[model samples]
Target: MIVTRFAPSPTGRLHLGHAYSAILAHDFARRQGGRFLLRIEDIDGTRSRPEHVKTIIADLAWLGLSWDGDVVHQSQRLSAYAGALDRLREMGLLYRCYCTRAEIAAASLSAPHGAEPIYPGTCRVLTRQNAERPHCWRLDMARATAIAGPLTWQDHGRTIVADPLTAGDVVLARKDAPASYHLAVTVDDAWQGVTDVVRGQDLFAATHVHRLLQALLGLPTPAYHHHRLLTGPDGVRLAKRHGAPALAALREGGSNGLALATELRVGRVPIGATDT
Candidate 1:
């Protein structure tokens, strides 16, 4: 049976963009007589909140989206993450990254993309036996790409070539958080036997790295369906970081979820519509 998942972090409230992503996964699964699952990506212990978790569940239910099986939380799967990390480390594809966020940004100032910078391999030369400060583990992109060999993943009925090297050496596990975002999601999707990955097109690039991880870890690759992201009046994508309001707020304010859901499904949300 086709299985898909909506994995949301409990860092903030679920907004219209989140609703669209979840609805896409749930509706697709239902249409195929398959299963739709929910996964709480709470691996970021510092930002993830229990109250946000409760609010996420309420918001999805309000939109009439029901997920199969108990909701899986990343915080509860540290051992699995550790095991994956260990496997990568054993293959010499993992390395310690000692650069702070500021340091990385400073080095990537001339990088092609502004603000969101790809990590320059600075601490990549440092070995595990090196005398240094607290560090995080990063996937050795160059070595990892070479090891994984040529790769590609199917997306929306198209064969897309994987170019994980551009993502740079991504963090696998941090000192504060046992597992990084990329590692956990890749591992969990395989663990849950997810057949399809449906989410925003914003994450289309990250699929390259995910495909590499799947190959390196000997996990099954899932077909990806990257849908259009819900945007605001300014044509900007809705983001929790940009202070997008929670769907629960709309529901509490007597907003019609069924109507909002229909609008989203038809891709015709009203201007300044707060119902969803």
Candidate 2:
């Protein structure tokens, strides 16, 4: 059976862009008679809020999207992420790096595009004691890619590809956090049986890291569809940072589900067309 999920970070309210993605996933699963799941990506504890989580669920329901199964929250699955990290460490596929943000920024001055401030393998040679210094855990790209070999996965119904070397050394666990986006996302997708992923094009570049993790962890790789992100009138991506209008705000302004569906191009009728 085809299984899909709409995982969203609860750092802010759901906007029209979120609705577009969620509806797409729901419709895809519904059309295929499959399952649609919801995952709350709240691993970034510092920025995630309970109110935002509540609002996200409510907003999706208001937009007429229903998901199957209990929602999976990433914060509650730290042990699973830690176990995956441990597996990588045991295989000698992870290293510890103590490089601070300032150090990386200084080194990035002359780095090439998509390769800014690469890890430089700073701690790849560290002894056990040296590795114990205040540092984050990074995946050894050379070792991981060697094991995974040439990596490729499906994206937007196309074959998307990645080379671990060009992707560079990825941080798996920060000093202050147990799991990064790469590790957490891979684990959650497998655990939830998500066979397909429908997300924004902005994340397309990060697929390299995700493919590496999936291969290293021996998890099934899912098909991906990276749709065009909804942009504002200014041509910039809609986001909480720029104060884009949220779905909740629009609903409060008396906009109904039909209006939202029309704006997203999912409604039966056109936006400004009148009924006969």
Candidate 3:
């Protein structure tokens, strides 16, 4: 059966943007006669809160989005992530990176525009003994990119492809954290049997890295649909920083679930338009 998921980091309440994504996933799954699943991306233990998770679940339920199975939490799957990292290590596709955030910031500032501080492969040459240092673990960008080749994944109305070698090595797991977003997301999507990824356009660039991870790890690459992101009246992306209203807040304001659904479907329908 076709499977899709709406994975959300429980760092904040489910805002309208989230609602649009979740509803899209739910509706798509239903249309395909497939299963829609929910996954809690609470890998960031520092900022993810139990309350936020609970609120996200409650809000999705209120929005009439139901799932077939229990929600999966990324934090509970550290060993799986470690296993993937170990496989890459055995293939000599992983190295240690000791650069601190400040150093990376300085390097980026020194680099020319359109060029992200392409990791200089500083730690890629570390000796086996040095690689054992607690602060090490970097991707072998050269090997990964070569293996990944020129790959493409589908997105809403467009196709995004990348050259693995040029995409740069991304951190899979940090010395302080067991799994980074890229690593965890790739694993979760594969394990959950997600056949399609429906998310915002803002993440289009990250798909390149995700595709690379899939290639390195031998996981199935899901079709990606990066839909338009919701924006506030100011034309900026809706975010908690700008106080973009959340679904729970709308619920608390006495808007029923159906009304909220209409709000989510607002822009697509012209004024005085009727549903056939």
- Superposition error at 123 for model 1 (Å): 1.2
The sequence of per-residue lDDT tens digits that candidate 3 reaches over residues 73-152 is 99999999999999988988886788876677666544567555666665667665555557747788778787667777
List, residue by residue over 1-276, the lDDT tens digit for candidate 2: 888899899888887677878888888898999999999989887889999989998888887889998998999999999999999999988888888977876765656775556766766776764655788889889878888888889876677668667667889998877899889999999999889988888787788889888988999999988888776655676666666678787766666876577567542322322111
Off by over 4 Å in 1: 127-132, 271-276
Supply candidate 2's per-residue lDDT for 78. Answer: 99
The CA lDDT of each predicted structure is 0.89, 0.81, 0.78
Model 3: what TM-score? 0.88
Better model by TM-score, 2 or 3?
A: 2
- Backbone collision count in every prediction? 0, 0, 4
Best by TM-score: 1
Question: Model 1, residue 48: what's the lDDT?
Answer: 95
How far out, in Å, is residue 149 in model 2? Answer: 0.8
